[model samples]
Target: MTQTVGSRALSSPRELTRVADRSSFIYLERCIVHRDANAITAEDAEGTTHIPAATIGTLLLGPGTRITHQAMSVLGECGAAVAWVGENAVRYYAGGRALTRSSALAEAQAVAWANQRTRLDVARAMYRLRFPDEDPSGLTRRGLLGREGDRVKDCYRKNSERTGVRWRKRQYVPGDFTAGDTVNQAITAAAQCMYGITHAVVAALGCSPALGFVHSGHELSFVLDVADLYKTEIGIPLAFDIAAESDEDPGPRTRRALRDRIHQLGLLDRCVTDIKSLLLPSGTQASEITVADSDIDRVSLQSDHDQLLPSGTNYGDEAGW
Candidate 1:
């Protein structure tokens, strides 16, 4: 979750001490400010403090949280991004650097390519999973097969129609398909969480988040990869529900609710597991890909009422694998 700044402000702050050469700890009180340091320790009001440079992949500070210049410098040297929560709880800060021993540019390019391919593969897999009975060969036909541009548009339309929400005039123009209100809000929330998570993962792997495989935008490459996987099912549906409940405008509470729903949807956990399986060395085989039949049964039971119609409720059950 991203941090947010509250109304409380600080009074007097202290100067940060440099600890680049040695392992040092710093403490943070309700009112204490220090300069960025090369390496220093820190403690919170609860007495829970440490030199995070050694362990944290990304450091996120809430509003009212203060750091010394010495600590900031040390964090930068250690290749950590210090993100701060704004008054609106949005995260804003800097310090994601490429720390490869090889040429930074070359490493960034390689990573970007690999990440792009990975994202595409994941997108294809998710589409196939969502529509297992549909013929893949027909997906590209002009009249029947849905194009990427059209698919995005259809996703917006279907979501908006399903939720009864209208898009702001400038939010989307004629022929310029923007994600609908529900999906857009959900996307924003997911994007925020995914940004920090992807950055953390990239940092742990000694890669730069700015140098993404498929994404080229300055501040969003890595998060873009994560979003590509999320939008297909999880974010789309969750956003639709949120839009349905709210009178079209989703506030922070709605975003929080959608976030909780995403957790229940299990997309992140499943995606992480799938990625881990893909990244494991070739020799290591995944033991199993299991889906609980009980869950399917529960869904089927819940939908039994609609099956009573004259249509006979086949629901694609006869489609062959």
Candidate 2:
């Protein structure tokens, strides 16, 4: 195998820019995921299903789900992230094995983040994506924040109008799920779900979640930045629609709706693509090759020395024997 190929999988996020999602998602419960020959398989009460780890962004393991070390290794090699959740995948407890070791993406991210102009360009690109068809030129960072806030308020009002729900503005109290209105609660639940998905994608791409362009001052600043890109389009609208319903608790419904929207939007795959675009706007950044060409030349020279002489030459027959 070529040294680059035998590294044996890509260890750099830049190399993963074009990687496609295998299944988009794999949520398993009451099952065990393990290695079956060269493939990853999940065994449950019903049967065993093959999991294409390489293309999957995240594996959600609910209550009763177990994974083997070998399977974890396979998922890591595939650059997939694992999330440990509660029953029905409602609560995210902790993260499991996520395969990534490249410093290239992280370093590139830092370089942009450290520069004022480059970071502003990235932030502007993100804003342009969020509000397409609108030019963000001549807008300062503070001006962007004001515009973003106005748009968010406008989103709530628009969703309320579309869903026939009363809009009073977004309100949520951390650690107190019931403190917020039904719409706020639903939005909170949906946002959490979105964060889980974003976290998985960010980790898989070998990027630091701590570094961010728009949002800052938090460990998950970048996660929040990516998550917010779709909230107005997905979470807010879904929450309002759920709130218009008669259920006393709409968290479950909102979550189901979010999952449906995620698939409908092809979000898992988009997440990977969007992250790459954000970190490296010009496209995938190049990673420096670690193995030296001299090493390869030395190996080729040694192979030539070890080979016996061919038998066709006049002096070769005696040496060949």
Model 1 lDDT per residue over 28-107, tens place = 23434333222344445665333435333456564577777776765665555556643322343465442222232234
Per-candidate Cα RMSD to the true structure, in Å, reads 19.6, 11.1
* TM-score for each candidate, following the candidate numbering: 0.47, 0.70
Tens-place lDDT per residue, model 2, 1-321, is 122222244333333333344444456778999975445788988997775556566677767988899988767666666777654224443343333344456667888899999889888888988889678888999999999888889898888888888877677766667777888888887887788778777776567888889999988888888989898888888888889886576766776677778888888777766766777647354433111212121111111555654333555354553
User: Residue 311: error of model 2 in Å?
Assistant: 39
Name the TM-score of candidate 2: 0.70
Q: Who wins the lDDT comparison?
A: 2
10 residues in a row with least lDDT, candidate 1: 11-20
Off by over 4 Å in 2: 1-19, 30-35, 38-50, 87-104, 176-179, 245-249, 281-321
